[model samples]
Target chain A: MDIGQTLYWIGLAGCAVFAISGALAAAEKQHDIMSFILLGVVTGIGGGTVRDLILDRPVFWLVDPLYLEVCIAAAGLTFFAARKIKFKHKALVWMDAAGMALFSIMAAQISQQWHASWMVAMVMAMITASFGGIIRDVLLDQMPVVLEPEIYVSASLLGALGYLLTCSFQGVEDGSANYLALAIGFSIAFSVRGAAIIWDLRLPKFPPPAAE
Target chain B: MDIGQTLYWIGLAGCAVFAISGALAAAEKQHDIMSFILLGVVTGIGGGTVRDLILDRPVFWLVDPLYLEVCIAAAGLTFFAARKIKFKHKALVWMDAAGMALFSIMAAQISQQWHASWMVAMVMAMITASFGGIIRDVLLDQMPVVLEPEIYVSASLLGALGYLLTCSFQGVEDGSANYLALAIGFSIAFSVRGAAIIWDLRLPKFPPPAAE
Candidate 1:
């Protein structure tokens, strides 16, 4: 398949992963089926929706709604599977990391397509990668994982910045090098986030003020 | 003043109020000034941003950015004032209710202007009216007020539906009836939400199913 087709499939997979993670999060609340679906769909689309809004682009899900269908299907499947399978916390984290990697790269690519500045592209990529999970946690009444002293947003940021740097350094004015850049960017994001999860990595906290 | 100018001023006032409410919410966390500004700006503009995205319109603040300035100014003021004043819980609630009322009417009117169906208008209105506070609560790691079995969203819904009903019944094709409708809509929303806050009104809980 061409690069466009590859990216399309990967984006859908990312949405599915995010949706499943959301359903898993909702499992903690033991909410009803509708709640699972709602949470799943919102988590899957919330980030990209916000990104598109900020960028003044057409909302991705609204343009086609196939993304919404994918999220709904994923949520429904997870809701049923959750009845039998005890979802592990690690499994959820891994899935979230994967989703974050894919979304971060894709969002960076889209931002580049829109001719956004490097800073805006990186910020958009981070938002697109992280905000979905944040929305899910909020809806579940849990502290968002991003707000913790974790490496989550940092990983996404590194990946997005890596993607932009790869494109620019390779002189991708004709856009021929974007496919390789996308892969490299995705890999960087996933590896950093994955390693952080396994090694329990965290960013350092601000030092308390010196005693008077 | 003309209705257009009146509405414009009210919208700015609403943004300021919402921004202050967000800053007040952040005071619970005692975060730095930057966090206060971020939270306040997000709460002030987030709902309308979502509505504009869904409606495929240019985002309101992007078109002018005056709203952003208002939010930032309000947040900065609140941050300083918080050091000197003990903010009351009741004050926040009342401010939130007023913001809800103003935003609900404005959103309903905008939906009508965009020629949305009654149901779509009501839903958009509720989303625009409530999502700001929901986002603020989420960022603060608090349970969203809308999800707490309260009459918040219902009040917005009622007001939006009331506005549309009044417009349609009165044959508002000429658009001259909109000012009266806006006033009525705002009054209904504020009265209902205010009453709920004063009396601790609540929606009924689901009854437990009978044993087989």
Candidate 2:
């Protein structure tokens, strides 16, 4: 496939992963089907939608109907199939990490295309990678995992930084640079996050402050 | 002030009101200053940002730095001054309603600029008026007030519909038509919401579904 096709499939894969993660999160809440679908769609599109809103760009789902349909479809699949799957938590964490890794690199590259500085690109990557999960957690009345010293946001940041560095240092053509950056960034995030899932890795949290 | 200046001040007023409401909401959580500020800023701009994102337009805060700055400043003011105010709950509801009224009309007008249909305009108005509170409630792990059978979203929808009707029925020029619509819309929202608050009005909730 060409560059455009490659990116398209990558983006859709990210959305699908997010969708499954959303359904999984909803399952924890004992919510009904509508809630599952809503959570699924929101988790699938929330990050990119927030990014587009911040950047004042057209929402991809609105312009292309397929993205929305696919998210709902993915959610429906999960709603019926989730109970049948063994090792649900393991599946969830790995899929969520994969989604975060893919979206982090893609977001970093897209931010670069928008001529954003490295700082902006990295921040966008974090947002694009973790915001969907944040939305799901919020809807479920749970603390966002990223805010809980989890490896999720840090993984995305590492990948985003990697992507930016590769682009600036490689002096390659745009197309090749993006592919290479994506490879490097995705690898960094995937490996680190995978290790985190396996080891239950987490950052340290500060003790609660004394009462005023 | 010309129309531009008029809208600018109105928008800032809406932001300030939202900022105060956000701070008030955070007070319920016993959160620290940073969390308050974050919640305040998110509440002030969250709705509009969501609207712009869904519509695929530039975020207003990014284009004008003042909006962000003002929201933060307003939040800080509330952080310091909230305790000193008497009748705080009354102040919150009144100020929030006022903000919703102005933002609903303004958002409806702005959505018209994008050539959205009346349906889209009203939906945008409701989003601009209520989404911030939704975000705030989500962050606080509380149910959104708009979902509590309150007249909030309904009020905004009513106002937006009134605005569109005025535009259609009146043969006045665009400028004058906009002003008149704003007046009509604001009046509808403000009076209804005010009465609701004073009378403790609420729509009946659906009876709970039987357990499966």
Candidate 3:
């Protein structure tokens, strides 16, 4: 398949994974189906929507609402199937990790295509990968995992950095090397996030103020 | 003043008020100055940024960064002055109300100018007024006031509806009636919100499911 087709599938998979993860999270709240659907769609689209806005590009879902359709379908499916699923929390974390990995690389690629500086690309990648889950957590009134002492955003940042470095070294010729970069970036993000989840890795916390 | 100039001033005032309100909210967390600035700016711009993205307009801050400058300045001022302010919570609520009042009307007007349907305008106004505070609360790990069964989004919706109704009746010729519409819409939103704050009004909550 051509690079564009491959990226398109990756983007679709990312959206579906994020949507399912959102539904899984919402399930813990025992919210109604409508709420499940709302949360799912928001989680799926939130990251990319922000990235597009910042880059002044047409919103991805708006440009091709198939993405939205996919999220809604995924949410509906999860709503019914979630009852049968054991280990939901673990499933949610794993799905979220996959979504983060996929989205970070896709966003970094888009940012590079838009000719954004590496710094901007990295930031955009982090936003694209993490903002969806952040929105879900915020709406659910849970502390956002990114704000937790976790390695989530760090993993995304590393993934984006890895992708940019690969692109820089391999030259941006839009060839097979692009696929290699995507694989490397995705592997870095997923592995880091997976390890963090397994080991319960945490970032250092700020020391309490001296007076406190 | 011309209607355009008047609306411009109102928009700027809205940004500043929201920024101050954000800093006040962040103060309760005892975060660092940088966190204060981050929260303030996000709260000031979050709503309108979403609106612009949805409406396919150049983001206001991106097009003219003066709005960002205003938010940063307001945040900085609030950080230094917050300790001396009596009734910090009350001050935050009032500032937030003012921002909501101003931004709702401004967003409705913009939506109308963009030829959005009245329904779309109302929804956009709600988003523009409420999303900023929602974002601030999310970041601070507090329940968003809008989702607390308060009359926040309702007030914003009413403000936008009032503005649209006035525009329809008064004609959209950009005349003195436009000023009157702005005043009427602002008063409606502010009074509704003020009354809610004073009375501690709340929307009815859904009953718990039978099993629970």
* DockQ scores of the candidates: 0.12, 0.14, 0.13
Docking class of 1: incorrect
Poorest 10 consecutive residues of model 1 chain B by lDDT? B203-212
Give the poorly placed runs of model 3, Cα more than 4 Å off: A16-46, A49-91, A112-127, A134-144, A147-151, A154-212, B1-42, B53-56, B59-88, B115-124, B135-212
lDDT of candidate 3 over A67-166, digit per residue (tens): 9999999999999999999999999999999999999988888877766666556756877998899899988988776655557877897888888888
Number of the top lDDT candidate: 3
For model 3 chain A, the run of ten residues with the poorest summed lDDT:
A203-212
* Residue A125, candidate 2: alpha-carbon lDDT: 83
Least accurate 10 contiguous residues by lDDT in model 2 chain A:
A203-212
- Model 1, A1-212: lDDT tens per residue? 88778888998999999998898888778888899899999999988988887878888998979999999999999888976765557668888999999999888888777666666577668779878998998778777776555578778988988888889888773334378788889999999988888788765332212211
Give the per-residue lDDT digits (tens) of candidate 1, residues B1-212: 88788888989999999998888776666655545666788789888888888888877875666787898899878776765555556667888898998898888888877887778788998899889998888787778888887789988988887787788878883334377788888889999998898888988767734532
CA error at residue A203 for candidate 2, angstroms: 11
- Return the TM-scores of chain A for each candidate in numbered order: 0.93, 0.92, 0.94
TM-score of chain B of each: 0.93, 0.92, 0.93
Of models 1 and 3, which has the larger DockQ? Answer: 3
Winning candidate number (DockQ): 2
True contacts kept of 3: 0.15
